[model samples]
Target: MNSRQGALLRALLNAGDYKTAGEYGRELGCSDRTVRSDVKALNAALAREGFHSHVDRQRGAGLRIVVVPDEENRLVRLLGEAEAEMHPRYERLCQEMLALTCHPGPHTADLLARRMFRNKQQIQADLHWWQGVLELSGLSLSLGRYLKVEGPEWTIRGFVMSMLFSFPAPAVRRRILPSLVGSLDPYDRQFLERCIAEMQRDLGFEFSSNAQWQFGVYLCIMVTRIRLGHSLAAWRDAREPGPFFAYLQKRLERHFSMTVSDAEMGLLRDMANCCTWQWSLAAMEAYEPTERARALADAIASALADAFGAPVPDDMRKPLAILLESGLARRGCGLVAPNPNEEAVKYEAMDGACLLSSVLAEVPALVEADLFSPDYARLLLVLFDYLEQVGALRCYRVGLVVNCGIDLALWGAHRIEKLSSRLQVTDVLTENEVAAAAARPGSALAERFDFLVSFEPLDVKFPSVTISPAVSRADIDHIIASVPLWRRGREVRTAWEQEVLPVGPSPEGLFAALHGRLVDEGLVDMPRERFEWLLWTLSIVKDRTLVLAWCGPGVRRTGIRIFRLEEGDGAECGRCTMAAVLVVAPADRGDLTPLTQGFKRLVEDYADTSGAVNDDGFFVCFPDPE
Candidate 1:
């Protein structure tokens, strides 16, 4: 079926009730006749494929899909395959790569182009982009009389496995694989699945659904690649496979009639170790992380400290080390955690994600090895939990000011503290003290407390949430809402600020000028090259101009420098007429939220020095230094 027909079929299948042709037409923005024609064509195609499913239509009630119980799986698979075919470019690229990697013989350009249903020119363009992707994995796309991907067998497998699992759903991957490798024998597939299930039972644990699928798919791919004359050499350095491998090996030989090698068996064992598994409490107690896992954990901890500008408690390392060890094999195999909530975690904790990215960057070993994936969100979530449990997370200090007696004031403070771990009642204050602090914005109280929680409404410069003496749910919600606003609006005390002179249009010129100024002021005390690398690597903050900020080693103090280009100097920084450079000291990294807010405001005010000012904001962040 064509792309539009595929879309129409999907809509019909997903629709809960009979949808009229007119209704479908309106939703798809087509005519009723066109919808009917597509539906008719889809039915014809399904019949031609000998499928027991069809779109049932009634005169007045409209259309619905009818599927027999036995045909349900087959029809669903067909729909999925059709959906995949909708994205020709991506599907073709994946198909081409699979064909090249699985077959040792060079594939002629014409053959690939024909199989992909594309012209030679389009195929060549795809090859060009695919070439760069391979190069990143240290693999080369060999192009000449024919095309092939030249790389180590292990690397090739890892890259392809990474691509396959990238689809997230194991079902989608299962469908795609058969198309690439021709048809898969139902018995062979079931045997491999059974082998994984048996292996899990033998280990006295259960692999997660996705992990089980991973093991099965890995086995299938390994066998296919091996049969196609691509197999890994014996890993002499690694330990030999155990009982489970022997069980799987015997099954593979009996089912597929293929003799499994020691190297292949070892690879399977390593993969099993990395797959996400659930164990009994007794199993957990008996487990200990390897030396390599502990070392990786230490590196991660060091990176976390650098990112947060605070010391990570040594005790936290053990749990992290355990997790690192559990996933070590899968990570090396380029598998990501099968986390359904990954996107949700990222959306909710964006700042935390930014912080984690910066932290993970410090661990060069992880990045170099491609161990850090979208699954980094898991690490960030764990770190946040650990900090909350240990009370080391940066808390929004709240000053409780009440007209009630000290008893009620303390009680209210206690209630507020229970609302969120990120909120801490730093002090119970009377109205007079809050008034006094308002007069002195730089007072010890003003600096200490982020915002105030008052029983009575008070005129104060600091953000305050007026609540009842007995805090209610609504009051709790209000406080929660205000905390974020306070983070974005509060004033920040910087060590210094200055306007930068024109440093030309080149990044080199700008870097040299800023590095010299910072060194002269003793704000940065690092080698010129290192600092220059940092300035570029740091995340940019866009507020009319690209602002780059970093809190780490070279930064001797917290400071911000403003740059305003002359009119017609928009080309100086690529459409930006102004820029702000902020250096945050390690100790003051906790102040990043307010400092960034303050700098944003500062940049907005100074953003229009030139008449040709762009109102857009740009900000980028990099890893914190060691």
Candidate 2:
């Protein structure tokens, strides 16, 4: 079947029920007639593969896949990533872009386009898109196809690696690195491995399993390219190498049968830095605010509970706090480490991540951390894991596979997970394993997933959806619209959406009101230095403050977040931050009964909660204006 047919099949299989041709067409980035033709082709392919399943047409509801239990895996193998082969025009262009960046040379645009399975015009359009994205790198597409990625050498290498490999799942990443490293000529691989081990031993620390695996991947990629006569330029002289790297290189060259090139040594030196980089107590303190950061973490856990109107277990606080501190340090200090789970985390726990990052970034201290990075996604995953451990996140099992190119596989899986918060996905297959499972009958993978999602139809008897690798925005919309119909979905979807609602009002107004109230009530505690500093930080933006304030005219009471930073011997509140809600509407002001009731619960909740709360906790200095 053509790529379009495979995509059509995926969309159909993924659907909870039949969708009309127009709906399918809109999702696959194609026309109704094309979708119909592709569906016809897909059914024929299914039959030819001896699968007792076909795309069945419904007059009004749309098309659905009719599946026989035993034939699922075979169908998926027939359509997965191996078959896609840069089939979509856009994918070919993407590959072309990578090829241009990694191995750029003189060639006409027409020649490159033909090589990429595209017409010249389509290639040019893609180049324009690439231009916009690549402008950050000062890279541009030369019209004649002589692609130039002009930037610092290290940046270009990293960008090429990102585009070249399909680093999708953590399992796949761990599995792939060894295979790639092992495939290298025994002497080179062995020597490199021994050097890494020796470095760890001599450095008085071991690299995390993840760091080692990624270093291996980096080495394998760089070595493979070097063997193919592509190596980075000698970016720095030998005299400038890190001390540990210099030592590690000398030991390696002493054992190797061949002389290592300066370029190769440069790469080796980089690997050394990556493996040894640590975020120690001192390093973290360089960013400051560990205690305050811990308080922010407590407030977030508390805020999430209050915002969602659910109680969080006390057990999640410490782990969440640790995750936040590490994330802030890593992002703030520019500690770029390899995190294979970044995609998976972004997919699985996006809302929790959004909420946490949204809360953390409000503090003036953390502005440097672009909490929106994939790093934050990885960090958020840790928080979600903690929540799940404490029975707060509410997760479910999902089985997912991507049969298309690596780009779509990662992108689609991320999209699927982001579109639903309940799903805890397991995607372990590499290109070969997926191909093997697709060709074999009754694979073990079928038993693990409650439902399988694949771009290719699988051969197993498990429930599976075959979607196009090129899942469009329309497809995502349709899938999101269908979430409530999934099993145990109604409550899950509702909670997921509200996990990170936007706070309103401008920064100046939010802080001014809070500051004015604290001063007016003689509750503005702490020295002028500390209070003003806090004000300067918190007042920078209402969006950045971690306060949980709910305001509406119909509310019978207010639930405003108040945090007392620390305690002092005297009666003065020491370093506090609180947002007050003023009631302007007359109808809801009949009694302070609701106020008392709400405050009781909030006080009860925040009592056990560790935040900036003082010993005289949850005190309301402002009396009711009414």
Best by TM-score: 1
RMSD for all candidates, in order, please. 11.7, 20.9
Predicted structure 1: lDDT: 0.64
Model 1: ten consecutive residues of lowest lDDT: 617-626
Q: Per-residue lDDT of 22-136 in model 1, one digit per residue for the tens?
A: 8777655578898899999999999999987899999989999897779877876686655445545445666777778765565977888887787888878777767756775
Candidates in order, TM-scores: namely 0.61, 0.43
State each model's CA lDDT, in order. 0.64, 0.47
What's the lDDT for residue 25 in model 2? 67
Worst 10 residues of 2 by lDDT: 616-625
